[model samples]
Target: MTTARLDPDIVARLVGDAVTAPSMHNAQPWKFVFRRADDVMEVHGDAERAMTRADPHHRALHLGCAAALFNLRVSAARHGLRARVHLLPDDSQPWLLATAAIGGVPGEDQELAALHTALRRRHTSRFPFSDEPVPDALLDGLRSAARWEGCRLTVAGDWHLDTLLGLVRDAEHREDIDPLVRAETAAWVSPAHATSGERRDGMPAEVFGPRSSAGSSAVRDFGRDRSMADRGWAVFEERPQLALLGTPTDTRADWLRAGQALERVLLQATADGLATSMTSQPLEWPELRWTARDPLDAMGHVQMVLRLGYGPQGPGTPRRPVADVLEIRD
Candidate 1:
């Protein structure tokens, strides 16, 4: 099969779709470089946006970037192109996370292409979810989505859900007291910066959702430190539905796979008409993160905790321009 060269405009459109993927605090720590001659797009992790205090090891960074890579693949499939992806292509350049050689023909990944409709529709909903449980079939489909990307998605049981909620509360308390951690989080979520349009990344006040009026919620309340006028409080569900995405090994490659799996599950959930949100708050701390996993469960290491139910979709957050993150080489 003859492969046609990918035009720069098409590459830009792909990158545009790629950046829409969710990230840690919406930090968007990924960059794309397209080689016109080779028709390949390189994904790189930007160290400048790294959460030094929270994610010193850059595990969250890898997850966020890999999510974008997954979006790129989906975009390629939707655009009648094939993205041949390689994770960590060059050992020498550790920051270069992955590369996708674009163009081979359409219909190679029809499943991925189908998820394109949900790309922009998926949002991190932090609002209170209804008590209605998600259908088991839908949950199974989400599990399959994760499995396709080389990860496992396990719906948390009652006991595990309670434990996970406690861990999240514990982590919240830690963040409340730790000055450095609070400062780091505060630096990323300023309403003034967002209002001025100076900052293209980070969580704005509008997307923080409401504070829990009663009962503990798995969603991270970003409004804890900042004062937001009229940020109404609502009663969160007593038994919030939660799912854990895990990987067998805890390596850089494993993190990348988990990231891809994370996006896949999220997109599938969105397509199935479920509101979704994720919390890495507990996972940021060593002790809390370790205890988040169930001993008996086959899921080796929990990568992300996801909340799925019926709720208000989160407001769209800002993203850096494609030109800002993408570089084209002749």
Candidate 2:
């Protein structure tokens, strides 16, 4: 069958939607190269943007890039096209995370296309969530979303939730003493760096949310290193409703799959009128990450800890221009 020609404008639009995906510290560590000849778009992880101190193994980087890849698939489906994706398409080039050959009749992937509306709507909410518990039915749908992406999403039980919360605190304490980790986080969350308006990546002060009034919360505190004017403190939920996203194994391929699963669940939750945020703090520390997995549960390796509840969605952060991240080649 002859492949339909993917116009340059369509490719640009797809990439535009893809970059809206959340990344570690808003690093946006992915690049796309579209080849008109074969109608393929290659997603590559930007090594320079990788967090060497926190993400030494580049697992988080891979996850972020894969999330963008998932967004690309959703964008294609919304546009009445189908994205045939191959993860880690080239072993020789480890940075090449995936390649999507976009071309298909309209209305081919209705389910995926349905998520298109949530692409821009989804944001990482760091503000306080009300005490209202999420309905079991909604949680079940999120679990199914992860399963569709070859991963698992398990709602944390009371015991597991407490354990995970403690781990998050432990991770925060570790970052407090570790100069390198603290520096790395400060670099991303600094107002001076973000206020310049020249750089399009990294977490800005506007989305840092309020400081936890009482104590440590499930949300990652981006303002720990520096103080901001009018950054008032607020009481977070006493018992946060957390969910764990995991895979059967811990490998680059598994990380990529988990990332896609993460985005799927997030988008589904957003579409369902829920505010969501993710914390990889515990997962960043090896000891804490290992303990994060429930030995009795079927979920093997925990990849991310997500907070889902009723709250205000986070403000939109900046993203690199499509011209910077996407390159068109013959």
Ten residues in sequence with the least summed lDDT for candidate 2: 190-199
What tens digits encode model 2's per-residue C-alpha lDDT throughout 1-330? 445498888999999999999999998999999988888999999998989999999999999999999999999999989899898888899999999888867465789899999999999999999999999999999999999999999988999899999999999999999999988887777575455667788888888899998889999988877768778899999899999999999999999999999999999999999999997899999988989988899988999989999999988888899999999988
Could you tell me every candidate's TM-score relative to the true structure? 0.97, 0.97
User: In model 1, which residue pairs have backbone atoms overlapping below 3 Å?
Assistant: none
Task: Kindly list the per-residue Cα lDDT of model 1 for residues 73-166, writing each as its tens digit.
Answer: 9999999999999999999999999999998786649889999999999889988899999999999999999999999999999899889999
| Local distance difference test, candidate 1 | 0.91
TM-score of candidate 1 to 2 decimals = 0.97
Backbone collisions counted per model: 0, 0
Candidate 2 residue spans exceeding 4 A from truth: 1-4, 106-108, 192-196
Pairs with steric clashes in candidate 2: none
